[model samples]
Target: MRSPASLVLLALPFTLAVPAPAAGNLGSATTQNGLTAGGCKAMTVIFARGTTEQGNVGSLSGPPWFAAMSKAVGAQNLAVQGVDYPADIPGFLAGGDKKGSAKMAQLVMQAMTACPDTAVVMGGYSQGAQLVHNAAAMLPADMAAKVSSAVLFGDPMNGKPVAGVPAGKTKVICHQGDLICAGTSTILMPHLTYSQNAGEAAQFAATAAGM
Candidate 1:
């Protein structure tokens, strides 16, 4: 049970040189998502974003996107968490770096702390998906056990498969016509592309229901 303040301190050392906005806006996305001083149990969902042109999480694409998806899944009873802090391609490529990974891990932990006792479901679009995938690997064993599922959209983790992700609970969804799906040279992976008709949405809905 690391306090939020202490976790921030632990995360500072690994933070990169990228310019962070004023403290007031650091968790602005969280605030806009309607997360206050309480927690919920239905499901705690974390939404990470892809590379942003602004390099900040307070963009229109991040929060609004999560809200839309939240409604689509009928997650009203679920506690939704948004991690909109933006990271560029360079930042993503540097994702495996110690600090970057720690920061991501810290965010996940904070989300868990905010909704202790709830099932956790981590989801992201494109590059955001990649970060969530990596963060899943960094989650503490006990916390990892609490993760009900992880949904990755648009982008894959390239070559590195996360080891701690609960088997049968992790899923990948990509756009069939999207060029990103073709570049994957591997098989036997649980991959569902948009070309699979409406099945992709159904799979996601099913996973959410289970959570």
Candidate 2:
């Protein structure tokens, strides 16, 4: 059998012919660089991807920001885990296909359990940004308090009232014209890009994680 990523390609052509499913699952798929061999605990950065994006929580190309942030995080000797979830259009509106928000809470709990002293810095883009907020809100107070920082870009719920990390620890970055967070859907261009702010975001996260 082919890999799940490859299988997506086989199903792509038919996706247009037939309706697509809600992309994938609500599992905690983490991609990191510097974890010690026997799961030694280290400072951690958790990233969540936007709609339709695949692989790790962050992409390596197109928008270089994610990759840039990954590089910076590695420089800090911290591990990065890109979270996985159903980020499809429908799934996002329906609050994820298998309780994506709930799974993220569990993911956080598991991470803390596995690496007790690990400092967690998290972020997400677009729909993934919304996921970050939802996940943060769902976590138990003690667990949520352990999170060092949360950075969100183009979150649909940016300006709205939502549960999330503490105000001081949370940073919401919305471009002037990005309507998703700004509530202006008429313009579709600005919402598609955010590479310029990736480095600054990474730096902030690194500092918050004490790296």
Candidate 3:
């Protein structure tokens, strides 16, 4: 358990930055072409941003996660992509953006097919985590097997396992007081600081990817 002092410290950033900045802080709005055009790297991360967050990959968790992952396994080996989808609140209310989730699944297939040997890491934060779950559900069992690891933060569907992906390959990180993980829509202090978990998530992804 985190001490009270730690809790206060974690809450500071969110307290000041109520609505975080856009993808420019971390990534861009689209990577549909980026991944397909570049061929393949040693690894690929297919990420989705949260509701109301700017760009395809939000500023909060995506950048920090990618940076840490690159450090864990050389940057030369890593290629990142964000699932382009309308990340509005309504989409989250509807159990993640259906089209967005489909797009994510499509991206996964593209990765597995184009570079079957490339290590694949799937991830998302908050509503993005919902996309991960929805996307995995769309993949065939054989295709899903190629995904090396998946990491979700502030997941609304916390208790459930990622569909078709083995339990061991997935890690859902929900802060102690995150209401979203409890199946509520209310955003709390815990949900906003998932970037702090980047290192731990990156290590898990790296180990799972065998990098």
Could you give candidate 3's per-residue lDDT for residues 106-151 as a string of tens digits? 9999998888888888899888999999999999999888789989
Best by TM-score: 3
Specify the highest-lDDT model's number: 3
Candidate 3 contains a number of clashing pairs equal to 1
Evaluated against the true structure, the overall lDDT of model 3 is: 0.81
**Model 2 off-target regions past 4 Å?**
1-41, 58-66, 70-76, 95-98, 160-164, 184-187
What's the best-to-worst order under lDDT?
3, 2, 1
Give lDDT tens digits, candidate 1, residues 1-211: 2133422333233233224443223222423332443456465656565443233333323344444445555445555555545454445445423444455567567766776665666766555666776777788888776666776665646434544766566766665454333443221122322223234433463465463
- Residue-level lDDT tens digits of model 2 in 60-81: 1113444455566663455555
Model 1 lDDT-worst window of ten = 185-194
Error of 2 at 155 (Å): 1.0
Provide TM-scores for the models. 0.60, 0.72, 0.86
Point out where model 1 deviates above 4 Å. Answer: 1-38, 53-75, 95-101, 158-160, 181-211
